[model samples]
Target: MATRATARPRSIDFNAAELMVKTIKGLTMDAVQKANSGHPGMPMGCADLATVLWTEFLVHDPSDPQWFDRDRFVLSAGHGSMLLYSLLHLTGYDLPMSELQNFRQWGSKTAGHPEYGHTPGVDVTTGPLGSGFAAGVGMALAERFLAARYNKPKHRIIDHMTFGVVSDGDLMEGIAAEAASLAGHLGLGKLIYLYDDNHISIDGATDISFGEDVAKRFEAYGWHVQRIDGHDHPSIREAIASARDDERRPSLICCRTTIAKGSPNKANTSASHGAPLGADEVAATKEAMGWPADPFHVPEDLRYALGEQMPEHAQNREDWDARLIAYREAHPELAAELALLIAGELPSQTFAGFDALLEGFEVGGAIASRKASHKILSKLAANHPTLLGGSADLAGSNGVLLPDTPGQSAAHPEGRNLHFGVREHGMAGVCNGMALHGGVRPFDATFLVFSDFMRGAVRLAALMNLPVVHVLTHDSFWLGEDGPTHQPIEHAMSLRLIPNLYVIRPGDAHETLGAWRLAMERKHGPTALLLTRQNLPTLAESRAEDVARGAYVLLDPAGEGDLDGIFIATGSELALAREAALRLAEQGERIRVVSMPCWEAFAEQDAAYRESVLPPSVGRERHLAVEAGSTLGWERYADHVHGIDHFGASAPAEVLAEKFGFTVEGVIERWAQIR
Candidate 1:
């Protein structure tokens, strides 16, 4: 039961800041005490910093939370959601006092953690440590990119900073390290983070595990570092002002403070980190702070101060709106383009040219689907100004580089191509931040096997229904000679299991284009495109439009001998299914080949459309599926599934294919035994 020194004495010149901080502390204490759940120490510890930033420095309009130029705020330590809720309520966002009273209760807007779309003023949904920290880097990157592309020398339209409060746990996570390194390397100076350097963790003391000099570490990463007293308003204000003055590097302000600022017994102890202060301690803590005894009581003076500031904040937005009108009149063409991007709308020409783009593509010979993806992405980048892309040090292998565009860095912020280095998890988190920012459509690439590292970000993107594209290549055991480590045997099926994720493994060059179209057009959720290392022959019967239906017949039995069997396949296996169907045709065992590119999309179709693709009259035993991956979930569509349940071994592509029974003769032999 370690205790911190009582809060340092201060002068009486900052009554407004003191009252605001006390109001936040009272609200957070009452909410956690009522729920009897959630972490309280963090909100109480960071309340003063939050109060100064929100009331004085933060440029936001309660009337319009979506104002494009509003400074973005993220709580990397989101376990303290009541802090954000209290600020939103005090600042007159749509959040009311009743919602704070019902905090952490079922069906309330205030959940255990802050969810982005669930709460107003919550820019990014953050619960897993380090996610919000990394995402803020993404938001800062977006701001720089947009400013370079749209803003003129005289008219700086997209100038806003991304601010976040990161805890000790956040800095400890590896994802934060990766993102911080990238942000510093790119010199994203508009990004600023306040570190809650409380020397306590849930395990008691951070000295037991985290013992690094955080300021020196961030400085080594090329960040502008500052140290400040978390409880001192003037010190915090000066630190932020100094950070803003430095324009070449991102800022990390280490704020040293107690975990529970005023608690009599639990302040600065791990006991207060999670559990609420007991009812008796809560009363005593209030008395110590010189506050009222009533729960959830917002002081009259505090409310009055906020009321006086509300109209001024709203008026700022009105002034910005007027400036925008003048800027639009001065530059109508650029203004139109900016307006379309802000609205997330594609141009009419791009929409009408979709058919021509599909029709103009030519696949004269077999090629790897990854190459096909590169071609589609290159064309998409040329046409859509908002389409931004990058890869995690696998751009050459994953084929994500767009021609005629320089890589995005400090020198060339307007470039659409991003080089995210070898940080797959960080790249995914950053992409989520870009999607949440809403001006650009962001996509990142990596080997399909590495998707495991970034699964948390992918899950969060789906939960938020972000329109992010994930291009994953080297999709199967066919990525030979790299051993089982690089081979992706179960990646596709595992990704499909995540709700609201559109998993598409296209079969050929044409289908690859179709997959990109679906990913670009999607607005409600994230999409994952799994591509191949092995070359797949294009089928003459394959059509891009059929892909939207999820599955369609690619080849039917000659003379239609009552449809004795069916072969279902996806990605490179579609070519294998065709070979198998041809072999069976010679035996008079007529078979139909169906290319199921996206199982989730197919499942979404009406029952009539689904039944048309795989008729009920066809016996379950007669339906055979061939995919070079895990057999899990195949039972929903196929009776007999030929897949690799075991890990792959080191070998050339041909040897691995023969050993795994994936060839023309091998398919014939397997079908003979099944029949």
Candidate 2:
């Protein structure tokens, strides 16, 4: 372990703090002005609050940005990314003054939004309004869970807080409401959010669109709510101190502020919300705040003064290092486990006997893929203590319940099962946070149809390449009797459109096991396992290992003389295609069946492997695709698609299968047309 030099505690210097705030404002205005395409108002208005929080309450070592116990600060209102960028530069993170100068530029660390892996100190990607707020809740949840599980008496290794600066837009977003309710219910006392109540939006005053009593609303949500002047340094400090002391509930400090605090003409108006303050207003703002006129210039004395606490921050990390060393000596096993988790490494024995676990499923027995997933998840969770998750009020339907685990709540911080209620959007965001928090592997479940609500967070997860699992059950119209509202027609293909998201619709119990294993092994990006609500027979030929290839030949023509055509299918339709191939074989026609459970995974395979499965020798026109959902992207592989392009009606799965031409005869007819 590395240790930073110890230093004497610095006295509270309000004068230096005020100068730091002005410098933050100057950096914000200059960076936005240089970019000519960024938000400056929010950063300007919230500088005082951010300055106090970072310099005083935030516990982080700039030298060791990945310190496990460091406090996480999320700029949830990410449009004002300059606020975070300036802080990172001043506090001596890898971000430099040049990067701030290159704000929003190509290849710069300072992006239009705060990106997690892209920036050294940024904890999570934040751009979509309430996503950061919700993810912060997840970070807090992770902290509480890990602390409860690993912290010993006099050895508090995982103690930390998740803080954020949210905007009016974030509070107005429904996702934030869902997350806020859950946070309050869980009593995540370490989660704190400073609401930038500037009362302004791009459409002008926020009252025109959002007029609710925000403080009263949070109070109703069971948070420790407070109101304060955002620009008042003393009030900001006091409010944060009070929030830190509240151990029974999450805290929300509503900070009233002007849009562009020091700008003469643009202050308190919508004009400065997103656009740069222009050269004239920049100079005027600088003059108004008694700041230097030079762009991107921070007085050397002020910079040195602001960074005086760096030694203290580094020393805090060094102290934690000592405690961790002591903790390892006292509890070697737990310390080892914590080390693996913090390093995001899985045990070597995690999958040592993986094949034996799959042997329990009878080859020809009928079972829903979702139910099979439950069995696999139960086994995996038993072996992988860090693997924990829950469904969004659909645990029964989604089969996301971990056997023998208590539901997570205020009273049960060590519980592995998280109850996300009906908040699909919030659940996804929270899962992202848990993944970003680094000690836990987070997954969430919901109906395949409800994934639409989580698209924003899901997309961000893929963009950040976070290894989060999304278990989506009731995968298609086969989830019948619930009408079109409950059916997922285009969801699988739609999710596949996301660059790094793997959408796997397992065909049977064996394939479901493969999906779970793949999800756990994948270290980057996210995976969506689409399981069935209706039971289907486990194919005798299905192999769990082959599922990793994304697609494989399930059934070839019997005593093949010449290959006639290939039948491609996924999920439940694999059985239908196999039957169709067998039926065609009986009729003296040679047909091949291909099971493609995951398009993204298969696409990742080498061209030779993909070619071996699809066999370009068999022309595209000779390929007939079978699936129960929309057939939009199947054309890439098959010329004839036997699928339901329209929404399904309320009926039994069998009845809908017949109505939608999903029978063996239907596959034969569709293959005939293509041939």
Best by TM-score: 2
Q: What lDDT does each candidate get?
A: 0.87, 0.89
- Which runs of model 2 end up more than 4 angstroms from their true locations? 1-12
The candidate scoring highest on lDDT is: 2
Instruction: Give one digit per residue, the lDDT tens place, for model 2 in 1-675.
Output: 221111122345778788888888999998988888999999999998888888877889999999988989999999999999988998899998889999999999999999988999999899899999999999999999998899888777888888999999999999899999999999999899999999999998998989999999999999999999998988987888788788789999999998889899999999999999999999998998888898887877767776788888888899899999999999999999889978888865566556876787788788999999988888888888788899999999999899887999878898999999999999999999999998899999999999999999999999999999999999998988998899899988889899999999889999999988898889899999999999989889998888889999999986737689898989999999999899888888888899999888899999999999988889998888898888889988988888888998899888988888888888888877765
TM accuracy, model 2 = 0.97
Tell me the spans in candidate 1 whose CA falls farther than 4 Å from its real position: 1-13, 351-364
State the lDDT of candidate 1 residue by residue for 1-675, as single tens digits. Answer: 110011112222277779888888888899999999888899999998887777766778887888988889999998988889999998889998889989999888899999988888889999999999989999999989998988775666777888899999999998899999999999999888989999999999999999999999999999999999998988988787778776689999999989989988999999988898889989999999998999999877778878888787787678678767877888888788878877777654444555665565554568788997887788787778878979999899999998998999999999888899999999999999998887898999999999999999999999988899999999998999999999998898999999999999999988988898888878879999999988888778787888887899999986744888888999989989898888777778889899999998999999999888898989768888889999998999988888889999899988999999988777777777787
Model 1: ten consecutive residues of lowest lDDT: 1-10
Residue 191, model 2, lDDT: 90
Candidate 2 residue 533 Cα shift, in angstroms, is: 0.9
